[model samples]
Target: MAKDKKYRKKKLGSYPLASVVFSVTLALFVMGLFGLLIITTQNLTQLIQENIEVQVFLQKNLSENEVVKITKILSSKDYVNKKAGVPQLALITKEEAAETFIAETGEDFVEFLGDNPLRDVITVKISPDFQATENLAEIKKEIGFIRGVYEVTYIENLVHSINKNVKKISYVLIGFTVILLFTVVILINNTIKLALFSQRFLIRSMQLVGATSSFIRKPFLSRASMFGLTSGVLASALLWGLLQLVSSEVEGMMELLHLEQLLILGGSLLLVGLLVGFMSTFAAIKKYMKMSLDELY
Candidate 1:
């Protein structure tokens, strides 16, 4: 009984360095990947929100009142999710439009023409979610049906191309993450198995001395759970440190890790680390518990 207790304590104490390295490395790897996922989603959302442009070219002879009425109709579409959906209609007056053209081209062509040939154009900034050609096509058809709209100009092919590329990149990243996760699990399993190898003899000795398999396995299970908990805490700390460095120095890189949410994410990561340790330990012990004394040699 005394020998068994000493043996369990000795086993737990023997592999501190290896366990620390394994826990820290695994935590950093997973946390880095998770951070990447967060950044991608945020940047994509921003890009989508900013890139929708829908142009409504008004008829050359429309009155100012008619132009204002058309602008109101375009602004009221429910699909424009006030916040993340469709942006407000921006009215570009003919004089401002002419000035823009002059500034852009540096040509005095409008002066040569002697009249403002440009009509009032309403610019619609759609949200990224509704930037698809099909959605734009429907919007175009609806607006074109209006009496005073001469044309609705939007580049459908470009939006389609961007969406397709984003989807492909997302799929590739997802696949790589799954593969890396599996590889980490296996690596941790092997590390734990090596750490627990010395206990095989102790387990057999306990069994031979009239100890039930459950009694013999209990001490190892408890030790495993303890190791798992400790490792989980260590891993979470390492991840938190990494995040802190990024947030402080990277400047506008990881604003998502602001104080409150960062604390929550760290707490969640600690739980995850603990689970990884516990499960890996349980699995390693279960394999040994099934081994016969003859197999220990």
Candidate 2:
């Protein structure tokens, strides 16, 4: 009798499980792809913001000490980008600017006009958190107040466009993610229901032999959890494979899609799979548990 019970327990949750895992895995992989795209967009936004340089032109005829003072002030600001504990600020002296202009335009303006019209400038890359239009304007106002600073300037239109487009993209992607989640739930529920159809009679036989409802649900739920976990792992594996293919075919792809971020995405997928799988299985089993013998036929 004990052996028979063990056999029944094994058979109840083990057969036809492959189809459930495949269906859930495919759904999760699709969702994972979209998740990857969303994170990529975020990364691109940061990269663009890092390149948005704010040029701080200095006052004319300033002494070396004054120039050093201005540089120190700008470097101390919170908005300035940093790398490895060093501020990313560059000073382009008027002499270097004239050389660059002469090289580019094929005309030595300083030699022609007897003066270098270009001003010495300090350029700073603003952090992404301060890349908003209003934030940049405030930064310009604050930096312009610094002594020996002539003018603070940046591409205002570019900043506005980035802020606007980021909002729009976030809204669109979030909407799509929510819609896909709902669709996946339906797909998983339907797939699990059909898979459980063949087991309806076995479930009824268990009940006829005085099995309780919770007892009957145990094996199915246990198997559902297992299938959910397997599906999540398989889905994550497929996503990793896709990333590998992309990184091989496309240069610098890994820079935008980082491995550390994968942990959050993978955890989300595992959670979704387990939650949806377990709930759908419970619901399907309840329906069978409530049905009469004729309904099984």
Candidate 3:
């Protein structure tokens, strides 16, 4: 009976299991929240970048064949955006442009001018990497020089402003991420250390009974690693639930959620949890092992 009781105590260890699990879960939850924020911000930035369009005005009276040829040339350029293996370039006829303008402004400009003055335009959405102001100016000049092209224009000021703001946002997010990562490491480390504090006597007892340091640390590390994995899984589930709730409540949110990015974030959290748990457990065991009996008391 006495030996069985001792065995059970050793198997359970001396850590506060519930407290450790809760603490680790809370830390991972905060980290996952920040990960979601970063992913959503990237998606939002991409959406804005994709909306920046450049108008390629063609020379007036170009035949249908010429217009088709111009579109093919523009689509082949490296600067253009591509989705699903196709270039995001659309050709708009002068008549269609005029009709759209009239419908938007609620004015019959065609009646006043007695002719369509708008040129057939190829609306090009540039790749996000090439949306810089200088790159755009070079692109405009290059496209303007293309045969059968009349003018190449875009909202230059808007593009410059977007780039400037995006740079600032990126800097801010980077700083925040660094600080958050540091905080998370410290928090998890402290939690694991505290949990191990109650096990100091057990560790010392095993050491005194001819147990190697690795033997003494093995079970504690294993339990801590399990704690980490469990906490990470719980945190990820909570994050997914929160996202699903938000998507259901908010219109257009489903469009912003990237499942691939979310999966990567979840996997990263699990790995971080395992790493921090094992390292912290190992450190704590080493510290307790080095302490004299008087200090441990």
Against the unseen true structure, what C-alpha lDDT does each candidate score? 0.69, 0.89, 0.90
Strongest candidate by lDDT: 3
Could you tell me how far off, in angstroms, the CA of residue 70 lies in candidate 3 after the best superposition?
A: 1.5
Q: Which tens-of-lDDT digit does each residue in 1-297 have in candidate 3?
A: 999977776662557779988998899999999998988898999999988989999999888898889898999999999999899999989889888999999999999989888899899999998999989999999999889999998988899999999999999999999999999989999999988877888888888889998888888888989999999999999999999899889999868877788899999989989999999999989999999999998
Per-residue lDDT value at 221 in model 2: 91
Clashing pairs in 3: none
Q: Which parts of model 1 have CA positions greater than 4 angstroms off?
A: 1-24, 27-31, 34-38, 84-87, 104-112, 206-252, 255-271
Local lDDT at 101 for model 2: 87
Q: Measured by C-alpha RMSD in angstroms, how accurate is candidate 1?
A: 4.3
Clashing pairs in 2: none
The 10 consecutive residues of candidate 3 with the worst lDDT sum are 7-16
Total residue pair clashes for candidate 2 = 0
Better of 1 and 3 by lDDT: 3
Between candidates 2 and 3, the TM-score winner: 3
Using TM-score, rank the candidates from best to worst: 3, 2, 1
| Structure candidate 1, residue pairs in collision | 80-86
Among the numbered candidates, top TM-score falls to: 3
Instruction: List the candidates' TM-scores in order.
Output: 0.75, 0.89, 0.94
RMSDs, each prediction?
4.3, 3.2, 1.9
* Model 2 stretches with alpha carbons more than 4 Å out: 1-10, 83-85, 102-114
